[model samples]
Target: PTSVSSRVYVTIAAALVAQLHAAVATLKPFVWQWDSNDGAPAWLENAVRPAPAGAHNTPIGLLRRDPRTLSILWEDGHRDDFDVRDLRLACHCALCVEEMSGRKLRDPQTVRADVSPRQIVSVGNYAIGFDWNDGHNSGIHSFNDLRAMGERAAAQSVENV
Candidate 1:
């Protein structure tokens, strides 16, 4: 009797899962498009609009708001504003971060509040390298990581509000 009841429960769960899958299959696919500046494709725009790979990581502009702030404008129209000190402290260079153990070698508390970049340079098309005012410049930050950080910061700000 117990075995029969367990089999019935399993059958009901499987039927419900099949129904859920069928419902999901009827839903449309989409991409969080920034804009169709590239012009719409021949296919139904939403149906064929594959998410632009690395679109957010492609920087179109970089601005220095002051000695303490940096702003990056991405190809997807997303802007990332980073405090210079914070960005400097987050460097992942071998000197700052132990390459073998993945331990943090640089203490954030030791980084001065006024720490900033003396220069920012494009490392090919995929990343940016910085010449920090404190003479630390080995770290190259990938645009993908930058975009992710910006997204997280934006979400956090919204949550805090």
Candidate 2:
């Protein structure tokens, strides 16, 4: 009786483990958000990174006063300004970034200096999608990635100043 029960327990444990993995896979997209700290827990470190804690990184307000810039106010009181043209050029859509090699296919010269967003839409809760006047709308830039981009741009600006 013990031998049979142990075998059943092993099968049940395997099924439970598989279910847990599936559940984690569903939440992987949320967990893999870009983080300022640039690391993750040991269990998920290699597979899924992390992002800002909850509402701290959520966009509270989005402002586009002109075609030149898009400003976002985060829930944590951080404001990030993004250049319209640069955002267009930095699109990670399949058309902008190669699907297989991950190389950037967009040539800076191909993007006009005044290229701007034709429409802006939210992608669920985690991303902002842009439709460019230049006729590309496939890229959906996540808020996490955008935050990182803004941070990099600010760093460069500071270096120049």
Candidate 3:
């Protein structure tokens, strides 16, 4: 009887977790696109930007990822660094939540190594979902989120200046 009860609990827990993932997935946007001058990948642009001198500092390239490391390139020729693990921890998907409660969840620092490379899943009107290598299939990051982070970082840079 005890074993049966335990099994029941496990089943319920799994169901609850599934429900959470579904909920988060719903928040994902569609049609996220980037215009790289001449259609270059965003990371490549980022990797090459920082090396150039006396160019437009505005990012000429921007990267988005579901599981892959996204990078950006400044028109003036400087690259910005982005970590894939950090991106995953910020997954806005419901499955990313705690099982017992449908609250949001983040990647624990210890589990960062498990964060997977992302494949661009679907492009939404303004967002994109990445398929992570670690089997995390949720977390669609919007362009707005990306731009906001960049703006915040830029603001911090000004503070440092």
Clashes of each: 0, 0, 22
The sequence of per-residue lDDT tens digits that candidate 1 reaches over residues 1-161 is 36998999999999998875433111122221112212211222222222266344655555565556667766555668988777777788899999999899987888887776666666666677777768888997887888887888899999999
- Best by the lDDT measure: 2
Ranking by lDDT: 2, 1, 3
* Residue range 11-67, candidate 2, lDDT tens digits: 999999887644321111222111121221122222232323554455655665455
Which is superior by lDDT, 2 or 3? 2
Instruction: Give lDDT per model, in order.
Output: 0.64, 0.66, 0.54
**In candidate 1, where is summed lDDT lowest over 10 consecutive residues?**
24-33
Query: What is the clash count of model 2?
Result: 0
Candidate 2 residue spans exceeding 4 A from truth: 1-55
Better of 1 and 3 by TM-score: 1
Which of 1 and 2 is ahead in lDDT? 2
Candidate 2 lDDT trough over 10 residues, lowest sum: 32-41
The RMSD (Cα, Å) of candidate 3 is 21.6
Question: Any residue pairs clashing in model 2, and if so which?
Answer: none
